[model samples]
Target: MERPQQPIEHWLDLERDQLFLWVPVMLGLGVSAWLWLPDPQAWTSIMLALVAVALLALAADRGGRASRAVAIGCAGVAIGLGLIWAKAERVASPALTKPSAVQFEARVERIEMLAPRGIVRLRLVPIRMIDRPGRRSAAALPAQLRVNLPIADLPMGLSRGAVVQMGARLVPPPPPSVPGAYDFARVAWFDGIGATGRGFGPIELIAPGDASGGELRARLSMHVRAQVAGGPGAIAAALATGDQGAIPLDDAEAMRRAGLSHLLSVSGLHITAVVGIVMLVVLRLLSLSPWLALHWRLPLIAAGAGALAAIGYTILTGAEVPTVRSCVAALMVLLAVALGRAAMTLRLVATGAIIVLLCWPEALAGPSFQLSFAAVTAIIALHESPRVKAWFAARDEGWMPWLARQLASLLLTGIVVEAALSPIALYHFHKAGLYGSLANIVAIPLTTFLVMPAEALALLFDLVGLGTPFWWVVEQALRLVLAIAHAIAAAPGAVTALPAMPQGSFALIVLGGLWIALWRSAARLIGVVPLAIGAFWAVSTPPPDLLVTADGRHLALRTIDGEIALLRDRAGDYTRMMLAENGGFDGEPGLLSEHRFARCSRDLCIADRVIAGRQWRIVATRSAYLLPATDLIAACRGADIVVSERRLPLRCQPRWLRLDRPMLAQTGGVAITLATRQVVTVRQPDDRHPWRVPARAAQGSDNLCCSMQGLAKQRQL
Candidate 1:
């Protein structure tokens, strides 16, 4: 006589152990809330009140089971918010404002050699910075500076902790190039890099510090490059030292396009390989002694050895966030083995993510954190599927069948991971690698089994001058990896570019994916609803119809042909590239001056286009010279929008919007959509944060005629 399980009880039983998997998701939501809030302080009281409610719910003994789960989720979110706020406050430092030529004495903290650029980048902490020519009081220096110098100009004795004096021109970390675009300034702020500069005059080494691990890493990179040469060498050096700066831009681009860029970063795959190798070698050595194997815990000893190796390698390779995360995951695996527990599970991934989020909440805003976690989570979910488990457990009749099964599993994993990460790629990079999964099927195995091991062996042999043989193997393996990358990247339909989507859509997609991955039973399939809706929303959102650069020197407008046309054909490469990416256009931008619908002149330009069933007229200034007062007024009077780098005369006003110098200075850059009459600025009016510089006071407007008269009087004086 056995009791039958109720339907609800069975469902609950299925998900009982899976509940913890949602903790990281809750924490990430909180982090996202903090980051996305325009004014964190304004929402502070509300968030804390919610936390209080959650706590009371938890403390109460008479509530529904659902209430307890909700309480746990709220607590996780509150902790995440508190963590990020504390980290931001703790790392707060002065940031440089404006540009200036400065001379300073500083201690070098780190160095990166950019071989293709022929420059050396140094992270420095300044002792004192005096303005150039000694004509003004010393300017307030940032907590840290990143400066680039010509390779030839680098002092021979320069090394980490070395004190040096140099003259350089520095500028504050730049803001976003467009509204809702990537914010490098915020990234720099979190990293404690307040400014960036280029060396000008001579750099004199005042004190050469003692030998350090950073010096060792640099020497190793140089030695590897010298031994291997070219792009392959750069990749090998990156594998060895985690210094990816030396990789040629072309090679890096190819790798990114081919979806093998993860190989360049030391993460789970690399760490797992390193740990497995160390454990196997150590275990084999211990087993060689029969008495020791019988008397001692050889597995435990090997696990300890592997843990040490993982930590040592993590530190040696600069300890990037992904690498550190992998190291933690690997250590946890080793700990599980030592304790005789099952290792790989959703819990392990969730635990690692929670630990990382706790320590570096700022990492939540970065692609590395999102992409890595998404990939891992997807892979784990795929393998843990009941159907997949059953298939894997089925008897293998022969070696060929087993091999086929393995290949199929790898392909399936790759596809799942690519699917999980595509939304993120589109949101951050505005593009997704369509062929990444296919490329990774070959690339991951090749990199994990052959390339990394060969590189490690080559490095070991280099110590005694016997590394040439292994180095050849390393070079050939890396060459094959590059060949795969370039071939895949050159293929048609290798990438899919999408218009940037709103944060809400992206969040919905992520939540849907998490729901599917973190749960079991029939309800998990319900996630498809939100997932499909989010995908549709992201794809259907229209791009901005107008974009203006921060300096107001470049403008792009959507034409009747649906092509993005730039005002200047000679715009800088970076700006042009970003605009194209944002617009989801692959071709070079056609010049608006050359477009059929626009009329251009020496001092002014006028363009007209129909958007959302309405014709909009746009006017822009082309020259610094003041236009005729009547001409300026006439051009703007009927226009829907006016864009000018110079402040317009009081008589010149647009019906809808006017973007002039003062406004551009405050907003940073702007993107507008004609259909909804919506406007977005790189720096929103309420984006007063720790790193943002305050906008200057505006000057009073004057009529063109009055300005001309004043200019004439000054000339007469």
Candidate 2:
């Protein structure tokens, strides 16, 4: 005790006390990589081989500490690979490969109202799949399918447990719209949904579902809707039953732009608020009763109550990955409090992440998992640092020191979270909330102190059939929250769009963030180098000049003025959003105007540009197969590039670059570089992974000819 602490002699002499915390993070990263491999069987064999070697190394114990460390690393890798293999096996099932009309009877497990789309999305569990009416088959179908039924088709109100027979066209979930975009098919696969489609004929309801959790959730949602109607009502229903389908699109966009979208989701913040309020109220009531207070350990009792509250809330919200994660963390913290130990530590957060990753390995590839853990880890690392603690201790004492300290903590926490999540937000969504901290300062307090507690009371009253009055109070609080969100989103520069960063750059940023957050010494500052490099690369990457849709039905080109001009106005929302977001353009897609650089007609649209003193003609047409012979000849006469919705004849454009249905299907969307005349498809051969279905080969070799000719011709010029 009398000896002074010795300074760390080497940069590598970092503390090993918290080294175990990194085990889960490393394993998760490895699992994520394994999931993206092109050959799952190969990886599985490799992992097994590594496990055997690790076991042998442990048995021999030749190199002492170094060998032990190597063995531990190998064991971690093997575990990660094994978890990924288990997940793949569990979710494997027969999937719909082509569109087919079939009569199927299914029980409606849940109904989500897509108000904007004027349809209801039903989550149905298959009862029977028939090739025809009254005919049964041994053919396997997906465990579940999300079917969209038009509102008018559902003349009878749809409810949970309602078995219905209907004729519908079903197809597998569509692939990603663009490279590195969100993969809905993969998400569906993990959710046990193999197909999606819309009902064509009338839906005949048979038997109502028995009283189940889903039915209860439906009842609660209907009650919430009946008690309160409009935007606030929709918000209330979401908060109560976790059904967010009814939320207006405009309101949702406003919340996202203002960075208050987390308030809408049932996450750690909402769960903690509900549990903390319930615990505080219960503890206060217990403390007033001297007999109980003297006989029982009050802190332990309160912690137990809070943990139970968190669990109840989790169940009410469907216990999704994010909700389950929050519940796990809350329970761990409450357990610590019950044991009279410090709770807010990196180890606890890591433990919660480990549990979540083990339960849902696929979640490692999602933004929510990454952002949530990054925020928590950064905050804990910052607050628990000696320098930060010393700084707080040195602050001058003044009136209301406790209040001042609390406010400072809140402000710093907001700042830390935003800083930690900014890169991830930019990488995934291509938009950063510039005023996130300012919005949080106003929104978080209101949401925590007034809104959630009022909601809890309203829910209790609703159970007793006296919820209307308290529901009005909750609506009022929600109105204020929405007003704040609107004001913030309306402010200038509230949300800034950034170009999509390269995958390598994003990887660097993530690695750098981990280094800075996980290390305990001053040498951790070295992480800033990779962070800077990633930032520079992200900003310097050039945008594509031309964009072609997967179906070859739409084309968008970056004009000389830097605006993205669509060859046609109509396109799917996903395709439009991907182009706009990646191109760093905001708002709606711009149509190619006849008065500008392009000429358009009923069936054809063409544009021209001068690149390096050579006139390059771009042509887009509807239904190449339907084009008249004369019109086709005229269109292909002098075109440098042609894009069409149907396959073109080889003789039609022998010397020109052509993109048509078959080529687009094989390559997905294509992006062109004007300077080098380089073409990049959204799906390259190297990007083929085992998670995606294999693509069929295109019919023609015209695309190959174009590539070779274009390069050779460009060099001659």
Candidate 3:
């Protein structure tokens, strides 16, 4: 008999970490060289040195298993580093980009409509630069543009696979990030784009465009949507199709509030759901066939079909990064089963992860990639337990087996997935959904049964004369589904914005999740680490310095001499998320109230107006003060210090009001221009309201000064 194998371990088992160390370090070093090295010689030297060290380490570790480990790490690191270096160098090639416009021709690869901003991905067309008179010879630039098309009046005919041409400005995507900053432009580049543009380009229609990927894929996608049109259906379509575009923000909010957003997004839950669905259906169908039941291949066919169907569904739904990563992982597990090989467990995960990284290394930077992979790894180990699997599979009189699985799996799997992912979510999104489980329960069935199917059918029917009933029914169902989602979302306590959790919490959660996934164990107590840390972090986060309302009203506290100046009735989504994370009151609020600027409230800092003197100047205070102003002809002038507090009834020609830095810049004047143009020789030394007095200069100049000061105070708050 063969020697007993080590039971399959979790992906995060301690040994896996040892494996991970080499890859990340190697890749990180290569990335470092590419990012930090100034010259080609430095790049070559660093890479070679790192390679030599890694090789030496591998050679030293050569002693059966230990040697294998070293070699694997070294090889993995080498590959990752090599890839990063290639991409960096390709982008850096001096001849690759033209600084001046040259006439070119390229194909339109994609069309992304983000309401106000539409992203049209195109292969390069030639660019031509217009030489300016009296200008010296300069670098020639490419004549391409990533069109920033404003579609207040959106055009209808734009479709996938359509080619067109136009004139625009073009620039390369930005470089990789510095140690601790975002480089979004560089990200866009890796997504296979060069230039963006706006409005319609001069077009010559190449051909009538059909839905993406031909009939079966498109039809299935359409069917999935049609089936899930209403109730849970809309959610199903979202998860199944990556078509969250049609989901109303409010409905989405409700799902989020209820903590069921993942159910509607085809996450690990969806992948696992499909896998179970395929496994059960395949086994049952085979059992029914007298001849097929006798053959082991019957179940195998079922498994294959089910897996294919799930993958098909994923493809129909646009196969977003999370879904794609999940698919890769699922496939890895399935392949092992089909080959009748002992499950590789963490090693399998490592293999799958390496495959994905090699294909899209840039995905490492995305939250979906992190969360999806992490969640899958956790659930894989959880499901591997005989006890856990038996419990889920055993008879339950409460509901249908499938339905029960749906519910249990949603909860159990969600718990596992969320445990590992909560930290990242909290750190990045800055809040945890308290009711996500409940949300998923309501959403799962709706998506699987109604929305995904309806949408799929509707799209199919659209192409054929026989699809009317399906289309109509799907549309009705979609309306109903969306309505319910909206209703649930609007309920009280539906969504509560929390403060930002720490990055440390998220990192720890990943670490703990990894641990739980890697080690084979009967009890799953260790899985609670992520949940515990996330909760503690969420609850303890501090209040915000500024809040911006959706309507553009901004609420923030500004400090002058440790006193807070409150800009009331203006708080927005961005500000709310920011405040909860940074959690500090830079200035002491004199007053706080609901919906107004008054002193002393329960919020982090009050939104009360304050005007206090600082060390450098007599900073005056004014709120809702009325002043006079005069207007002159074009040549005629105005006041030196013009302070427009709220608004003056009389137009001031030279309303020189001294404005404070409470309304303009969010930071102080430390970084403003030193050019001083306007000053007032005040006639009244002790006017109760010096701010009310209109001096003889321009209001615009005072506004600039006030903006600078306001900016300073704003950062503190």
Candidate 4:
């Protein structure tokens, strides 16, 4: 006989204890509202909206039924919106309008060494800027600037808190590479970085400031590198000091593809391992004395030690978003243990998320925050299942059975977490690991149990100059981990790449996942509907047939042979890669001039593309030079769209849209669908976010050749 499903009300009643799990979700919705809301509203308007929602919630609470819960949910959403809105206002700063070359003196706030690239990056607070005439100007600049100094030019004794004078070229934070791509400018805005540039000329050390914590971190990283050599040493330094800048690019990419990159960062797994080790040591020491064990509360004392260890470890690891979140969760667990309650649960995870959001509301949109919390939540939810709990419970069995059970449990947890994170991974990185579970089964235990402990001992013994043995162990273990990562990454179908997913589809998938993980009753199964629909929608969405960069000098299109064709064979690596990824092609693109679908000259290119069963012609500029009016007009006579890097004369008009330099400047980038004549832009015209650069009025230049030369120089940079 088949069992009948219960009503929504029955399920809700059965899962009443699970309501708190939705708090973080509600708060995240509010954050999303602030981030994705099309219309820009004033701070006053946001405050009023928050007040209205809070009052409405109060009124709803007075009513009967489940109105109170609804009211609370609404209030959470309002708080999220208000929190992010306030954060943006607090961090707002002016961005650079154009590229500038000038002399400047600034205090170094931080330093990061990129060993692979042989660059030393400095985060500086400007003291003043000097013009070409050697006069200090009052022109406003960003509060913080990130400058990259070539290793050869890096001055000796340059460290954090040092003030140095140097000449460099500065430019505004770059916009998105294509429509619907990640916005680096937005991230820069939140980080308070107004400009990014490269250093050149002589670097004169003005004042080498006193030693600071940053210097200690740098010294520790350098010492670790010196003690151990090669990729293993780099991994050890990353694990020990949270400085991943020195990691080799090849090794990092392999780890990323193998899904073991999380080990490179300080997060829940690392923190938990450290805390557990500390607690075990403390407990063992305290139990040595029977009198003290009976008189004192040993577990509570050990938990306090673990809590302090978690905090200290977080600080040592730079206190990044993921580390801080893990620290909060660990503290909550310790508190629960002190109060004699359940140490780990969904409620605790939700609580930790809420705390993190309250502190860094903008983190809601970042991959680190989302991925870390989502992975933990999914794992906790899985373990909370009654069937899973019973299966892992103790039983009278052989050591082989126990080992098999542990292995199965690890595999199951990995698969569930991977499934929950796939949509998010695809949405952000355009790729997700296919064999992450298989790789992590070996990697996690190796890193957590063998490598970290050995590295910690090595660091401890280094104070007495007797750390060689421990360092050797650390090196050998890490070498094995790296070997496994490389092997897994090279395996067939180790990764699956997809095109950018629509925001709406991503939202549905996330919401469905939340519902399934948060609820305990049959109603949770209902989430499968939206999950399936979102996946189908994501895969079936048609990619743009024609795409143009914001600068308008570069363009890519899908040809009749279903291959991606680029305007220039020597286009920037990042630009070409993004264009192919956005167009749903995982491989290289051919030059449009070489393809049968397009003909190109030094200044002009006309590409023929068929999208959605309709043929369309796209005419675009291939260089920064302006073509003769007659030639341009005659060539683009009946073109569907004209994308020119130089401003097109009014006499030359396309049938549909004309995206010139000015238009592209306002739009950021463009993606077009030929069949429906639909167009998508990187940014909306009405977006009044503080980070957005206002469109500049077009000005006439007396010498077009000079302007073109400057553009060429900028492109080279």
lDDT on C-alpha atoms for all candidate structures:
0.82, 0.75, 0.47, 0.82
lDDT of 4 by residue, 1-717 (tens): 532323434555677899888888888998998777744565447657766776776775534325556767878887888888889889888777677777889999878888788888889898988666756554566789999999889888988789999988888887777876777888888899988899896999999977567778888888999988989999999998899988998899899989999999998899998888889889999999999899999999999999999999898777777788889889999999999999889999999999999999988998888899899899999999998999998899999999999999999999999998888888888778899988899999999998888888888888999899999998998899899899988898888777678998999899889989999877789899888889999988777788888888888888776668898768876788788877777667889999877888988888776667766778988877768889899877778678888888877667667777766766668787666566777766445566764222122222323433433342233
lDDT of 2 by residue, 310-429 (tens): 998888877788888889899999988877788888888888887887888888878888888898898899988888787566466776986787778778878888878888888888
Report the C-alpha lDDT of model 1 over 1-717, residue by residue, as the tens digit: 533434545565678899899898888887877777756674486578768979787886243455577788888887787778778879988787677778899999888888778889999999986555638865678889999999999998788889999988888888777775678888898899978989965889999977488878888888998889899999988888888888998899899988899899888888898888889888998999999999999999999999999999899898877799889989998988888888888998899899999999999999999998899889888889999998777684899999898889888888999999899999988888989999999988888888778877878888899989888988898899999999998899898876667888998899899999999888998899899889999998888899887777778887777678888757776788788777766556788899878998867789988888998898988777888889889988989888898888877777777777756766667788889877766765454455663222122223323433432342233
In angstroms, the error of model 1 at 58 is 3.1
* Deviation of model 4 at 332, angstroms: 1.9
Residue runs of model 1 more than 4 Å from their true location after superposition:
1-13, 131-134, 559-563, 600-605, 622-631, 693-717
- lDDT per residue as tens, model 3, 537-612: 6566443332222111223333333233334334444343333333233212332233344333222222223232
Candidate 1 structure, TM-score to reference: 0.92
The weakest ten consecutive residues by lDDT in model 2 span 3-12
Which structure is stronger by lDDT: 3 or 4? 4
- Cα TM-score per model: 0.92, 0.89, 0.60, 0.91
Error of 1 at 716 (Å): 44
Predicted candidate 1, C-alpha RMSD: 5.7
